[model samples]
Target: MTDVENVAEDVSLEGFNPFDPATQQCPHQYYAKMRETTPVFQVPGTDIYMVTRHDLVVPILRDTATFSSNFSTAGMSPDKELVEKMKEIMAEGWPPVPTMLTIDPPHHTRFRGTVATYFTPKTMATLREPVTEIVNRLIDELPADGEVFDAVTQLNVPVPIEAIATVLNVPVDMMADFKRWSDDFIAPIGSNPSDERRLEALRGTVEFQHYFAEQLERRRVEPIGDLMSDLVQSRIEADPGDAEKGLDVDDEGKRELTMSEMLSIVSQLLVAGNETTTKALTEGVRLLAEHPDTWAKLRADPAGYAPTVVEEVLRLSTPTQGMFRVVTADTEIDGVPVPKGARLVVMFAAANRDPEVFPDPDAFDPDREGLMKKHLAFGKGIHFCLGAPLSRLEMTIVFEQLGRRLESITLADDNEFMYFPSFMLRGLTGLNVSITRAA
Candidate 1:
């Protein structure tokens, strides 16, 4: 404890397992407790420090130099033998996936740049028509009596995944396989007694790698007019004569985007970019249902679109529950010394709802003109999400169309609002609503 004032009330580790299933399914109460009782706390036996407050957390994520983005695997202690056995079963399908979720600095910047060019707001706008077409076609199928449908399973989930896959030139028929693999990766599987569920995700990952490899190889020969092709063709090659500058590459005539680099790009986008946005729409629709007045206001305006919905939805339910960082060098965070290499997790989900930051934090008010109206759904600074523009574009188009087309909507079932069970992501599982005629 490097000579700090006692402004923060000391918090006990007590019996909090942030990753526990119960905590994940419904983290609002847990987040509220963390916000009030102990904003900054350390879990017992785990070296990870949990920063729960919005104010304290904002700077931690923004100042990446002091706090690192690395994590320790001291907590996930599943039987190794089981992981191995499943690996063997899922052989050839378990190729390692190198994603940007677990990285820092220079390399992160370089990789983000290559993919970012394709998803810039301008570039993303080109996608609106096609995406809207897809949405309309999907909605057109909705019955006139305002038939009940699981928003997640039917429209919200498929839209982005399909859009991304289409852009990548992945076969439409393969969307099912892609979706199944995504589920295996993100959906919780705690009962895997032998970490077999994780093994399955591993298998899916490996298969994904193999698929990308083949796709890259195909792009090498038959160049498709798409982002994937652009990536494979991208060359951050050696700045010639600067012997120390160039990165080693194979015979593929490429540099920077090694197999690892590609894995990092594709895996993160497919998983993080996919699930986060998808979960967001699910949350958005559910919130609108819960708050009919808000829904009615939007349905009338139509222009409020997905942009307004996205902002309000993110404010209401942050998709990224927490972002982890590690202290690289001796630096002070919130005026407290964080020893070198200490892992810190900035809880943005909790922070977004901070009463100090947003008045009536619990309530949904889209038009609340906060100066930082953007929110941290995509984070801030250099490490900000690359796919954000595309995400916003897609979601906005989806919601605007839904808002305009959705005449009447009601709950399909009274099943409790289901949320993705995890510390990192938050969204309802199945937001089934029958839509037509009524606002």
Candidate 2:
């Protein structure tokens, strides 16, 4: 289909609105227009600058010194009252502080180093069997032949949280509570930002702080063989530079992370571990269901072809569409000058389909040549997603088993698929599908 023909009959390129029903249902046409014209353009009604083209986005992702990952620069309130309440929870421990997600180096370098070893490909490789088991357990719960279900709630949402809860050594009984916390934690800043949403997010943050503070205390007394225990016992060896700053340390001169400090790391993991992957899995299923040809190819050789399928789904679906970066100094993107302290919205979804980089960018082709060229789905540079390996693992395993079990799958209705309203996230609200089991 030609670019203009791809757009819904009523929606015009000049009138594009991401939140609009037509655009959300089909965003590729709009992204294509943005790439073809204003690669570095401002949103129609917002000051946020969007970097659409692959060339423009790669530079922003790479130039960490000029573009920071800190979201605080976006000018959201810190909520002083919440800080005061958390002080009691933190006590001698440091209160929730900047984590790898929100901090820029050299502090980002120091903080990421604390947990980087645990996320390496080698460490993540151990999760294959457990993740597969989780996928199978969820699949077993599916109804007997010719039944329908909301895949998002039944599978996509719960499976990832189970994997995350297991990793954190959080009890199975607390799965519901963890899901609640995860929902409330990230809800505040999605598509429709509001006071009510902010309040909900704060409540979740406080509740999470209390629960994890207790967990850290338990791990201190009894070092369980889990990620949480490793974090509780780990300490930062005081450097000579620390002595210059007159910081206190133990006899060995190493400082352990405080309860609140550990909370920051744990919370980021809890949210990152589940949320994006859940959405990605949902979209992956939708993609396969919509394109039977691709589905057939994947099922034929899941073990060999599943990885490539996962990459294509990630590129097209792009769980986290974009993230805010603070410009440190004056810079020009595609020759358009941007001032210092400006908030640049780096659009990963836009770049993933850039025609220059991916031939036939609009189509979903897992066999597309040069498939190994890294896509920004997990991002790039030092701030690249630590959970990328685990996310890919979860999607691949879920589909690998799914391809084997299902003879066919298709959407249950003709209604437009609904998406979560968020400035940064791209996900389905529900995906009802009919399944036909294999004999």
36-93 per-residue lDDT for model 2 (tens digits): 8777777666556778898889888889889988767332444678556545544544
Model 1: per-residue lDDT, tens digit, 1-439? 1001122234333687777766666566656667787677666666567787777876777676677555543235567677577658556643443345566666466667677777776777778888889888877876666566687888888788877876676787787777776776564422222365676666676777788778877877888877778777776534354344456554553465666567557766777556788888887777777778877777887765456767877766778777777778876644456667766777777787777787767677777775235477777767777777877877788878877877655777655775655677677778778877544
**Reference-based lDDT, residue 35, model 2:** 79
Cα-based TM-score, every candidate? 0.87, 0.89
Clashing residue pairs in all predictions, respectively, total 17, 2
Off by over 4 Å in 2: 1-27, 44-46, 73-95, 237-247, 250-254
